[model samples]
Target: MADEITASDQIDEITDQQFLRAVTSFEAIIVSQIQVKNKLGDRLNNAIRAGIIILGIIAVSLLILLLTLSSQIGRISNVVGAMNQDFSTVSVQMSEIDTAMISMELRMKLLEGIAGQTQVMDQEVVAITADLETMRGTMAGIKSSVKGVRGNISNIAVSIDHMNVNVQQMGYDMQRMGRSARSLNKIFPFPLEY
Candidate 1:
């Protein structure tokens, strides 16, 4: 009985020591699991922060690009308006040019009519010059005939002066004869006056 009791007491002491060791091992395991969970949580937080920073940079770049595109579109609209105004000015100038061309065409037609009249006038002038040449030849013959007539008139004037001298001599002879006849009548005593 005493051997059995000593054996029973040793068994009880061995069971108490094993229970303390098991409790210590369980506490160590729980502490290690908590540390691992904390480390994972820290890593997750760092990743989230880095992702937020990258997303912010991308958003800022997109906003800048949008603003630049809007400004370019506004400038393009202004240029288009100016181009429309220039096109309107060009159209007005073209209309004026068309009117001028029409006026020039009418003037050209008038010039053509004047040119035809000038050609006819030139032909008439040439015909008149030919007629004048013929008249000049006839006038030359008339001038020669007038020169001969002038010489005949001079000869007739000289003959008229010679006849006047002879007439005066005859008148003197007649007067002498009339005096002789009167003396004879006085001697005869005939009445010649009756």
Candidate 2:
């Protein structure tokens, strides 16, 4: 009877110590779960902060790119203005060329008119030369006719002087014969003289 009572008391003490160990183990498990949850929350917060910083950097870069694009657009506008000025200058030069061409065409027409006048003058000169040659031929014929008339008049004058000399000698002979006949009538009688 004494040994059975001692065995029952040792079994009760063992049950009480096992109960305390089980309670301490349950509290330790709950603490470890809380620490794990807190660590996970801190990591999530850090990740969110990193994401926000990256987004800010991207937005600022996009703003800078937009500003650069605007600057380039301003430069392009200036270049376009310069090109417009060049085009206007070219148009003015083309207009000047057109005016010069018109002037040249007018000058060419004037030259053509002058050439026509020159041709008419050349024809007039040729006609004048032909008329002068005809006048010279007429003058030469008149000179030849005058010379022939002078030669004919000189020959007629020579023939008339020769006939005048023969008439004078015959008149002298007739005078001598009339004187002889008078002398013979005086020698004959008074009747012959009467």
Model 2: residues >4 Å from true position, as ranges? 1-12, 115-194
The local distance difference test score of each candidate is 0.60, 0.59
Stretches off by above 4 angstroms in model 1 are: 1-13, 115-194
Question: lDDT tens string, model 2, 61-127?
Answer: 5565566556555655655565555456555545655554565566556666667687765665565
Deviation in angstroms for 13 in model 1? 4.2
TM-score of 1: 0.50
Name the candidate that leads on TM-score: 2
**Cα misplacement distance, residue 14 of candidate 1 (Å):** 3.8
Look at candidate 1 and tell me the lDDT of residue 123. Answer: 62
